[model samples]
Target: MLKSWTAMFAAGSVISLLVVVSSTSALRGQPQPGLAVASAGSIHLALGNPSGATEDPANKDNFLVSKPQYALSYNDANGIANWVSWRLNKNDLGIQGRCKDSRGRDFFAADDSLPTGFKQIKPDEYDFPVNGFDRGHMAPSADRTANRPDNCATFLMTNMVPQRPNLNRQVWESLESDSRQLVTRNGRELYIIAGPGTKRGTIADNRVMVPASTWKVVVVLDAPELGLAGVNRNTRVIAVNMPNTKTISGNWRSYLVNVDQIEALTGLDLL
Candidate 1:
């Protein structure tokens, strides 16, 4: 079943049809023809297909998978995602009195449904309490609290990468916090895509890949308020590329970059 589904994804039939459904249902205004859209389980989010990158590895090998909160392009060989995409909105956060996954598990776990020959990454692969690396979240847990299931889904190991402790706990965490604030302050929805810029290296007993840096691309829009028509040259886009090392300062905003810069580094076209 999974193989066949991935085959369809490679043929572009599954996600193409899904894009049409997402564009029609999620947007209040007309979406430009042939824009890239990603599905977060049932929710469809828009990506304006920013130009500059020659290609996106996520669309390769049919490993793109969608959960209720985010979509990731898994690289089974490297045991990490090339990118994870998700939709962020006003209602996506702030679950009063609920602060964590109700399952009582704070650890990252394997995704069993992944295709054969791909070993499920373990929670301890991040070298916690030893090498000082953290299992950093790409699609942050804070942004997926629309429901408990949504929040828990973000804990999948595939959505994580090995990050330095200081970078993860300080700067990276700040960026995740800012994403939610951006939505609340603007009164709109945001589309986010994030991933690692990896070098030829491995960490944690060679089980996990080490990212040279981490990057994210965000497209801000007043969706359902201004709709797809709101996306234009003037649309506010925030792109950040931060070092994966411990030397990163407390301010994540210091790494602010343009979408083109991120595209050039990751070979991904993100708007």
Candidate 2:
């Protein structure tokens, strides 16, 4: 139905299809075609795709939500000021997971994750008691609590990459705070898509990195009240890729713009 409608109706609808569903790692010199710059978080970008023709990584259809909350980080240099541990779920799953099957490797396998999202897998058959890479998290513990594992399951080793201690302990913690704040503010459930980094092809030398280098994390916030529309109407989306810079430095697409400029850019009544 959706495919036929776009084929029959809008011409622009075509490009919108693939871009809506894909989340690429940081690109070299291009901002994602349809995203806008967001002001909040270490990185921010978002867009509206009412069609639902494309599948989102964080889309609820592909995943389920569990206890996602923030818990305080014991390693916070700032002490009690650092209250984190938002989403808490184990990555390694038992047998019978949707993506797991005894015949194949586990999607959340620590040292032995099979090719996930491509096929079905079982738990016992997974590369368990594995080693090498950390059980990384797409949705860090800084964002969830003791809840359902499906949503938390999405944050498993498959979506994890070995992050640096400083990045996780301090920097990413900040990003976590912002993520929780938004979900709290929305009052409506938000969908989050996250996955682990792979070390197979071009990144042959790279392990599932624990510390985020270049810090190209991205955040997308929607809902009229956020004032996102005021920025760049063409891209009511925020885009910023990890810069590959040594110190993990970057800013939001909205960092340079003010609320007024955003209002002008989007022509929305953001003020």
Candidate 3:
């Protein structure tokens, strides 16, 4: 499936029915080998991008080229990601490298590098405090604090979606902390993919879609290599689907689910 998708991606412009999409030169750095593309912009994430799902040509879906820190399948019409994928390890936890600017903002401008006709969303456009939602991080910023590029990439509006405040600040935040600890305990790398289930429709002038629920798939591996060889029946896979509402409690663990369930809900091949 990955091979087929790669073939299509290599074809380029096959899915030209998109509303707007953009691409830009990658940042200057040693490219991470093995991945299909070593993002041109910043330091590439260790796990590589996820693949296997085909986009509907009628919709405004497009694969946003991977940046150094993370990669996303962006939906240009709704101005959000279908999914965001990246790698995380204990080394990414502390020691702030030069990923942010002096003004304390993301090094990359919101959607600045997207393809030419794509409708880019800005960071402050969410109006979180006024809109009663948070500009939630699909690839969380706190998890990539180890350096500037990785951390700053998480702030891109392309990596954000409208999330309820309680879910973003409380339960979701706690779960993120736990994920880091899980890596520290096992001493391995984790590949994570997260996105929204936007059954609830849009918010804030219909600019950002409101997901009825948000979901995540975490693949724990002792090494970094593509394919199902590393993941088996016994492989540790964590999947969670949390409601997009204010009633969620602080315990994110309570929302745990199986990877199979997430795959069914998302219609994406995670492995």
Candidate 4:
């Protein structure tokens, strides 16, 4: 049988959908005989879909886009992702490096997969030095280096947000590196969700909204093969909420927060 739960935000507004599958067939990567898998073969959301996003064009703000590399809820009005979730394991790591364009510059391209009428953010829209924001990635490039195409998928503009230099390069990057350490060194599998919070303002001719803060939830598991069944009360969940400003701590641990706090802030039931 299939069961589900809902989490309401502190504001008494937003609600999060949590789907739980009980069948052994579902755990084995197959849908139960009568049910259909939403995004077949995509293990990125093995844990859950935080916001209940769908591919329905009418739900522009919470539109779901699933890919082999990762899955994200694209917000059309904000021109950013509501959240991006992916599963990380040692097998996903490799010697492959970041992708580049013909000129050998870092390739940040528009996601042609977005439905028509959705603005496809351009790489140059970030306006780097002038804007003082890095084209921050929700799914860090290093986390998807298993192959060329996988790594390149991370460069899609839809997976990016405007982030301050200090937070992006220092604390955020450090946390990303540590997440990989859990996989490469400690032999752990992780299901991570990350996104912007509380839009502070807009950029690129008011095309993309800048968030006041950024947050992430990392659920560490003992093994990738075990998947969601491995998670329990003892699971190690690392959630962090960091301010997006010029001044911030270099250590990611300094911004640690509880998953409930993140849910209150982002209104997503991250598991």
Best by TM-score: 4
Better of 1 and 4 by lDDT: 4
How many angstroms is residue 82 displaced in model 2 relative to the true structure, after the best TM-score fit?
30
Cα deviation of 238, candidate 1, in Å: 0.4
Collision pairs in model 1: none
Worst 10 residues of 1 by lDDT: 1-10
- Candidate 1: tens digits of C-alpha lDDT, residues 111-216: 7656666768887777678777788899887887777677777778988888888888898888787778878786768778888885747876777788889988
lDDT of candidate 2 over 188-220, digit per residue (tens): 222232222221211212222222222222223
CA RMSD, predictions in order: 9.9, 16.0, 10.7, 5.7
Candidate 1 runs further than 4 Å off:
1-45, 48-62, 96-105
Would you list the rank order by TM-score, best first? 4, 1, 3, 2
Query: Clashing pairs in model 4?
Result: none
lDDT string for model 3 (164-212, tens) is: 8899988888877777777777776777889887568776578778888
For all candidates in order, the CA lDDT equals: 0.64, 0.28, 0.64, 0.81
Per-residue lDDT value at 222 in model 4: 72
- For residue 236, model 1's alpha carbon misses the true position, in angstroms, by 0.2
TM-scores for all predictions: 0.76, 0.34, 0.74, 0.87
Query: After best superposition, candidate 3 residue 10: deviation in angstroms?
Result: 38
Candidate 4 residues lying further than 4 Å off, grouped into runs, are 1-41
| Leading candidate by lDDT | 4
